[model samples]
Target: MGTDNRIQTIEESTVYGLYHHGELIYVGCTTLALKRRLCFHRSDASKGNDAPIYGYIRKHVDAPKEDLEIRALDYDTEAAALQDLGHKTLNAQAADGAEYEGYDWTSEEIDVLEEESLNEASKRLDASFNQCRRAAMKLGLIDGDGAYTRVDWSVWDEALGTMSDPKLAEKIGCSVANVNERRRAKGIEAYQSRLSDDKVRAIWTRYHALEEATYASVAECFNVSKGTVARIIRKETYQDVERPPRITIEVAKRYHAQKDKSTDKGRILA
Candidate 1:
């Protein structure tokens, strides 16, 4: 895994260090953006990779990522930092012959996108709900008596317990806080997906039989992405699971509706 004893540098390469409580613990160089590189480290750490940095993060999983500071250094400083930090820095070796890569997007960017989306949604709702209501009435999206656009609360009932507030909001085109408020109001618990063989079969069964059981809704129900549900339905994955026989959509709908109602009742009672 060693390069030809030559340090490789990208056109806009960055040398960065990971610090814990003001002490440097890791050193590396990347052609990628700083945040993007950190995101990759975080992903690898979550996947239980064998790297020392990953092990450190896994051991301190309860601590917020901010506690592990990422600070950029001058291009010429990689060797000095690695030497100064010695074995305490989690580098296998210095940047000699190291290859760095760049990416256009990272998980951190996705989180920023979600937060920005929620902020924009809240702003629109606060500033223009009444105005949009009038516009919607003229466009006939709502009747005259409706002063504001009302979400079909029934549609969200099935989704509340299955997915996180952010996911539910993204799926239903609302703010995370708004989805959270509605869920808490009804005494629904937060989303925590529990996947297993039995759960996979249940997801497949419902999607195949229920007309209202869309990939998005079913994914929400199982706390997975819509793509995951689609892959399961299309047999791209989970090929060993036995496919259940198709049933009437009406019967499926009735069963699901009753199940959701019962689940909601249980939550409220609890």
Candidate 2:
């Protein structure tokens, strides 16, 4: 079929092709209005996306919009669009009508990631540990020995002595084994949460007193994990701390069900 260049009105839920200098370069399907989807493509490209299509768009960014001849067709799904477009364009991966797997990090992004702790970098850059590590190695920022050069264990003694190996490992962005090896060398025991006995008793009291007081909320309030709050409620760790009388555990259990149901409903709505 020949390219249709006369259409000016772009409707919703269609497949579109972006052509530059009469050469087909990219094919995409969007449930949003075609005009809005095209705007998004331009925006992402301007923001330095690493995809082939975005890279092409960046090259022609200063040119007139009509230069990239957008052709749209009414298509039900991306697979249908791919079948029609003949899979010859520059798509980063196969589109089975779901979220794209994997991402390509820019060199600048990897450089910034290498400066932060593993956990901090992962959250800040929205890249996994393995992803950051791989990008660093690919950019020649780290040596091929697989050893992370960013961590400094000299100042980690206090944390190593007080926190659990797993928790410390997560906070400092290293492996649990590494934390364990360091702690054992210093003759430190496993983490016993440093929350005081008074704080422990307060967590139990708050859980039974408030209908909205979940293990999570109580933990956040006291700066501890939900698991630690559960252990407190069950009198597992702080057996010395006593619960206030007439406070039934069944109340907390009922609220837990309510919280879980609301969370699930929110996910479905989203």
Candidate 3:
């Protein structure tokens, strides 16, 4: 970043103002969709986000929802007229009953905490995600349940033996350590590249000579992606290696003379 020239205020939705007990906690200017902007704050509020606004909120009630009312601040001609009842949790200096001082939570705060997620709670409490997560877990707010997709180990075994663990992990959405662990568990050894550049070039030449060869097919044979094949072709590193365009299905059928005999439409020759 030379000067962070990115545009702000995208003329989209945004927060006009945030209110707690009719007092302005924080103000935001945005260009995101109003619904989306509101959703973001509502979501963060629900998650316990620790951004300055939520931190300000934590001082008063530990949760914003109790005295919190989300309204378009533009509707109020003189918002200052709304009473600031001086709720103690809203008291910036009060450390005795606030989350900043002790773990003990007010019933209103606890109610908010229970309603919102750990991430939201963390925001309200101005604590870490882990801190909120642990508290939520302890409080039985979260029911541990996750659906996991099963990987095809048979296909993985084939690829694992030919490709790097990191590559396999990228393809499988698993960690490199997990890939290694799985390999070890399955008694499969780590992959070692035996082919030299010359050998690879030779394979590429031979594969292109065959009628069935295509970028995707060749890439699969070479244990790489199609882009790698395309890049090698573009570099012209393999001179006089004729990489022909893929045969269209229509062209193939016409060349083979598979005529639609029911109609008088006969095949054409190259």
Best by TM-score: 1
Segments of candidate 2 deviating more than 4 angstroms: 1-12, 60-64, 84-87, 98-270
Each model's C-alpha lDDT?
Answer: 0.61, 0.63, 0.48
Query: How does candidate 1 score on lDDT?
Result: 0.61
Tens digit of lDDT per residue, candidate 2, span 110-148? 556658755567778877876665444433444323233
Window of ten residues with lowest summed lDDT in model 1:
3-12
Best-fitting candidate, scored by lDDT:
2
Rate residue 6 of model 1 by lDDT: 15
Q: Please write out the lDDT profile of model 3 over residues 1-270, one tens digit for every residue.
A: 342111111211223555676765544443333333444565575577776555555556555434655444442222221223223223233122101222444445556666765545657875565444334433445421111123667777656546887677656744467677766565444566324455446445635555666778878877766765665555433232343345533354454344444234533331
Candidates, ranked, TM-score: 1, 2, 3
How well does model 2 score by local distance difference test? 0.63
The count of backbone overlaps in candidate 3 is: 16
Winner on TM-score (2 vs 3):
2
Error of 3 at 94 (Å): 27
Please identify which of the two predictions, 1 or 2, would achieve the higher TM-score against the true structure: 1
**Model 1 agreement with the true structure over 1-270: per-residue lDDT tens digits:** 553211222224567887777787789876554554566677788788997778988886455356666678755667876766667777766766344332222333323333444344335344243333222232233333311124687887767757777777766755466687776666454566425557777888778766667999998888888977887787765554566655544567678789889999999999
Query: Against the hidden reference, what TM-scores do the models get?
Result: 0.34, 0.29, 0.21
RMSD of each: 20.2, 21.9, 19.7
